[model samples]
Target: MSLSPLPLGGAAPSATRTPSRSAALALVFGAFVLAGCATEPPPPPAPAIPQYTSPIPASALVGRYGLAAYHRPQDATRTETQARAQCSNPYVITDGPNGGVMMYLADDTKLTEVISKQVPGQPTYIGPAEDPAGGERDRQVISFNGTVLQLKWVDPEIAKRYGIMVYVRCP
Candidate 1:
């Protein structure tokens, strides 16, 4: 048998195949792509907060009020009378450290600072500063005259439990 010279830049003949430069580079690039994806994505942007300034000032609502709770709208008028009678053991609303009022939240015994907030074309709401107007912890102002103030909880379950709150200003 006669022997021939091998071609230059050509891999020697072998049982195992040698990877090309492009194939090796592609493997390295794929590893980099996977490594880049391993890290978590950036957090979502914060929500825009609306301006909350009530037409009815907090100072106007500060006082001792005879409080009553009723379910039906029809019962509101009657509830006012009951609320007036409860003046003996009234619900007290005091001035907060800031301009807000201090009152008890739904199902809470400790008094919390409640802000009166009104959005454009929306009913006024009362809740802690952390919550938005008409939020879960907030209560919509049903009605407020010089002597009477009515509030309904924004949360239906809480409204059902607490009922419509009627506050008749004590003399």
Candidate 2:
């Protein structure tokens, strides 16, 4: 395109003076931020502890016990909803470094399809430790005498089948 003549000895404005995209976006963003500043929402309030906890029970290891809950995938689809809900095992105390008792929580519990019947070296089809239980495989007891709680996974194949883990503890 042909350029227009200069006016009163002033040089002709260059066509290269077009604004950059980032400059345009910054201008628009600044206007938007200024508009939002006029109507900013108030900050959230502090969390309120319940007053019903009048007298707190004192335990040397209450906080030490990790909170355990089912961590299976949420039933979102029709197929997953039809499947059984996995169970989560609670915390247990075991000897840690320096002979201290370390509380551990087990969360992941999933049902995997049984593929093989027997291994090369194994004799039996599968032992109690590797077998899924009969009727829950449920039957258990938790004995806590205000201090130490003995939790033994009693039901046959409960630990083996469900894959009870103890890696992650409660926050």
Candidate 3:
């Protein structure tokens, strides 16, 4: 009794049951690739800087105040009017070196005054002057005395020109 020679190149009969090793390897690689793609989101950005404005203190006024508050004994009335007129013309006030006052106005009206030392840092406009120079010359400089609001000027000329002292209560 002789068995027939097994066919070396023909298709095998349909009962194959072995698992594929390459297919298992591909499944694991796909899972690892998917896991690597997952990630956490980043954090948000920071906030903006604050803007501060100067406010007037009512206690600093001496007597009945006028349009442009008095800066000195001499800067009583006339300078007050000029300052008020300057203010009416949309003027801007700035600081100068050696604690001076720099005033800017439209149509070529500029004035500079030197007096005491100005408070450090940028100045903020409070509002109209309460003494002589009407609504026009109504400007003040920002300052602090241990957290207390103080108006300051360095220019004596500015004080005289504006009809008020270099420093005063904001109002």
Candidate 4:
């Protein structure tokens, strides 16, 4: 006995079997869940820091000028040749603890060798005054007015003892 052919599209004994709606829905939902659970990548790092240094003025200590003894009467006058010789030496000028300039002569083989090490490329004063105590231990305060160099002691007692000296630069 021959059986009648089942309806091709019907769920009951169809000729070709198609995927059920529940199975298709489950596959699409699984693909979206995997996409949502995936991870993102991380970010990068930062940069470095710079070093500090001082910039001194080039115009502050150049030219021919004279320095006179501020305190003592005997050491008052300095000749132009002597003044030029004094200024020709290289030295560093810094601020004193008090409100004045501290001129440190660089230790050279010549006159200032007895004082401190000579700083290269430094401009020498036409005539810069010296501290009376006369050693590396000595500190003197100086003031400049383009015309003259005024040497004063920070200690009032030392100033009274040593005195201030003014040096004039020869034109």
Colliding pairs, model 1: none
Candidate 3 similarity to native, TM-score: 0.20
Task: Give the range of the ten consecutive residues with the poorest summed lDDT in model 4.
Answer: 49-58
In candidate 1, residue 78 scores what lDDT?
92
Lowest-sum lDDT 10-residue window in model 3: 57-66
| lDDT of prediction 1 | 0.89
Candidate 1 Cα RMSD (Å): 3.7
Best by lDDT: 1
In candidate 4, residue 146 scores what lDDT? Answer: 57
> What are the per-residue Cα lDDT tens digits for candidate 2 across 2-81?
87778443656776675667889999999999999989798898655222211112222233333222223341232222
Best first by lDDT, ranked: 1, 4, 3, 2
lDDT of 4 by residue, 2-76 (tens): 877666555467478677788899999999888877955456543332111112222443334544344445554
lDDT of 3 by residue, 1-171 (tens): 976665444535447744457878999999988887885546665444222332323222221212344555575445445434443333233454433334332123555332222123644443322222212333444343422233433344454554332221222
Model 3 whole-model lDDT (C-alpha atoms): 0.38
Error of 2 at 94 (Å): 12
Model 1 is weakest, by summed lDDT over 10 consecutive residues, at 3-12
Instruction: List per-prediction Cα lDDT, in the order shown.
Output: 0.89, 0.34, 0.38, 0.42
| lDDT score at residue 131, model 4, on the 0-100 scale | 31
Model 4 has an lDDT value of: 0.42
- Ranked candidates, highest TM-score first: 1, 4, 2, 3
**Candidate 1 ranges with C-alpha deviation above 4 Å:** 1-19, 37-42, 45-48
Candidate 1 per-residue C-alpha lDDT over 15-132 given as tens digits, one digit per residue, 9 for 90 to 100: 8877878899999999999999998889998876567877778899899999999998898889999999999999999999988899999889999999889878888999987678
Regions of model 3 farther than 4 Å from truth? 1-54, 57-72, 93-151, 154-171
